[model samples]
Each structure stands twice: as structure tokens, then as C-alpha cells.
Target: LHISSSWVRDSRFWKLVDQPAPKLESFSFVMERECDVEDNLTVLPRIFQDDMPKLRNLALVNVSSWPHNRFANLTRFSLEHQPPHIRPTFPEFLAFLAASPKLQELVL
Candidate 1:
């Protein structure tokens, strides 16, 4: 799944299904907010519960929050244009890297 939109609200861009993506191999979401709008950061809900066994690629742009899932099979992960306040802590980012042993590409 890939989504790219401009001038979208943080809430509206994240209304995803509350279920596992069992067969999903790649997922990317890019949202661009209007320049005049202030950031209303929101945490991504724990919908998948870290059960995406087959997921290999993940990317997000201009996202305010990180998901609470441990991706074990991800081969590529990318995060771009995130606000400084919403950036992951060092340990948190390390934990995510540690969880994905198979990760081969990472972009920030």
C-alpha cells in the first residue's frame, strides 16, 4: 500500500484498519500539511500489534508519530520530514533497529 497526499490532517491520514497486514510486503505513506497549519502531533495507534510477519518494506514521510510495532522482517525502512519534537529517542530507534535483524536499508 502506498499513499501520498497534500494538505491532509494528521488524524485523517491515519485512519487505518485495526488488523494485521498478514500479506503486506510494502507500505508507504507520505502526507504534506499546509504551511500555515500548526503541528498537532498524534501517536500512531497500536493497530497491527506487531503481527506483520511478511512485511519487508516500510516508509513514512512527514509523519508526527511512530507506530508501536516491532517489525522483525523489515528489509527496508525509511522516515523523512518528521518534526524534531516527534523524532524517536536514541534508545527507541536502537530498539527498532535491534528488532529488525534482517533490515538492510534505512533512511532518515
Candidate 2:
């Protein structure tokens, strides 16, 4: 399920995210914006703290901060087009992967 739109209001987006997706297996989120504007969007840690145990494929594009821990059962993960300032450090990225023992493919 791909969701694409122009200038989605922040409240509307978060409202959709706040809903529970219990059986979700794969999720990819892309926030389209002009390159010149700063991308300050953040994914809170609790977004995936529960109800995503079956998630296998996860990808995030143009995201600023990803602070979730729902990759324990993921098989494929990708993070792309992130802003320089909000990107995670190499060590932090490694630690995030370390928690995903079942991960088979990774793209940073």
C-alpha cells in the first residue's frame, strides 16, 4: 500500500500512524519534499515498540530521525535519502542492526 500526496498536513499523517496495525508485515514510508527545505520529520521510538512483531520488510526514505526498535524479526531493511544532520551514526546503525538477528538484507 503506497501512500503519496502533496503537502500532507502533519496532524493527518500522525493520526494515521497512531492507529494500530497489528498484522502489518512490510512498511515503507516516504516523505516527498523539495531538497532545499529541511526535513525535520522524526519517527518516535514507540511507534514500533509493539504491534509490529511480524514486520519483515521496512524502508524509510527522506526521513530525518528514526528512533524505533521494531526490527527484531525483519528480513530486509533500508534507509535512504536522510538528512545529514539527523542521520544515525555508524555505531548506532550497527547497534540497530545487531538487534535484528533475522535481518538478511540491509541498505543504508
Candidate 3:
């Protein structure tokens, strides 16, 4: 699944997906905030819990919060344009990296 929205008002897109995506392999979301609006600082809801076992590639742009879940099978991961306050700490980032030993490409 790939989604790019240029006029997002809030960050609740993930919450609308109540069911798990069992066959999802790649997911990408990009939200371009309007200049006149306040930054979207909402943390995204945890996605699909532990049900996305086949997920491999993930990317997010202009997003404030990272989901508090482990993705052990990710081979490509990217995050961009995150606010400083919501960025993961070094230890937390390291742990995130540690969890995905099969990761081949990473972008921060």
C-alpha cells in the first residue's frame, strides 16, 4: 500500500484500518502539511498489531510519530522529515535497528 496526501489535516489514517493486512509486503505513507497549519504532531496508532508478518519494506515521510511495534522482517526502512521532538532516541533507534537484522537499506 502506498499513500501520499498533500492536504492532510490530521494523522489518523492508520486508525481507520481496523483489520490486519496479512499479505501486505510494502507500505508507504507521505503526508505534506500545509504551510499555514500547525504541524501534525499526532502519534500514529499501532498498525495491525503483530499481524503483518510478511511486511518487508516500509517508508514514511513528514510523519511525527513512529509506531511502538517491532518489525522483525523489514528489509528496507525509511523515515524522513520527522520533527526533532518526536524522533526516536539513540538507544531506541539502535534497538529498532537491532530488531530488524535483515534490514538492507535504511534512511533517517
Candidate 4:
């Protein structure tokens, strides 16, 4: 899911994420802006927790993972931040792989 807009005004996108998708195993989320509100990312853990049990790949660009716990099964990931390097460093993106304990590939 490419998250190109923020929920500052309203959470219209949340509706799309509410569907009960049982076959989804991988996800690619792209957010262009950074909004640090609590609820901003809080919706993630619930949105993906059910369908991502077998997920193996995940991608995030120009976004922020405040809690970062939503990705609990990713095995491959790619990220490109604004500066392109600091997003991973802000909180040890490599270490965050703990969420994806089976991860083997890390593409910056």
C-alpha cells in the first residue's frame, strides 16, 4: 500500500486498510511525509498483524516508523528516506530486523 497522504484532515485511507484480507502475506508501504502523531502509526500493528503472519518482504520510503513494531514478519526490506541514510540510523534500522527474525536481505 502506497501511503502518499497524511490523515491530518481525515482518515479516509483507513477504510481501505480495514478490509479483512486473509491471503496477504507481504506488504510494501510508501509514505512521503513524516507525521509523528501517536495514532499516525498506531493503526499499523492492527492493520497488518492478522494478514502478515507469513509475510516475507516489506518496503518503506520517505516514511517514519515511530513504534516500528508493526512489521513482525518481514524477511526482506528496502527503504529510501529523505536523506536516504538517516531513516535507518535514527533507530538502527538493521537492528529493527528483530521484528523480522527471518530477514536475510537489507537494501538501503
The candidate maximizing lDDT is 3
lDDT of 2 by residue, 79-107 (tens): 88776777778998888878999999988
Superior by TM-score: candidate 2 or candidate 3: 3
The C-alpha stretches of model 2 lying farther than 4 A from their native spots are: 5-8, 39-45
What value does the lDDT take at residue 59 in candidate 4? Answer: 67
**19 in model 2: Cα distance from truth in Å?**
2.5
Cα error of candidate 1 at position 5, Å: 3.7
- lDDT of model 3 at position 88: 82
Candidate order (TM-score):
3, 1, 2, 4
Q: For residues 1-108, write the lDDT of model 1, one tens digit per residue.
A: 887776444455445535667888998867655323335333455545566789899987776766778888999999877776668899988998999999999998
Models 1 onward score TM values of: 0.79, 0.78, 0.81, 0.56
Write the residue-wise lDDT of candidate 4 on 33-62 in tens digits: 554443343224346435546667666654
- How does candidate 1 fare on TM-score? 0.79
**lDDT, candidates in the order shown:** 0.73, 0.70, 0.76, 0.55
Query: Which parts of model 1 have CA positions greater than 4 angstroms off?
Result: 6-15, 34-42
lDDT agreement of model 2 with the native:
0.70
| Candidate 3 residue-wise lDDT, 1-108, digit = tens | 887876544446645444587898998877766323336644455777667889999998877766776799999999987766678899999999999999999988
- For model 2, where is the 10-residue window of minimal lDDT? 40-49
Sorted by lDDT (best first), the order is 3, 1, 2, 4
**In model 3, what is the error at residue 56, expressed in angstroms?**
0.6
Model 2 Cα shift for residue 98 (angstroms): 1.2
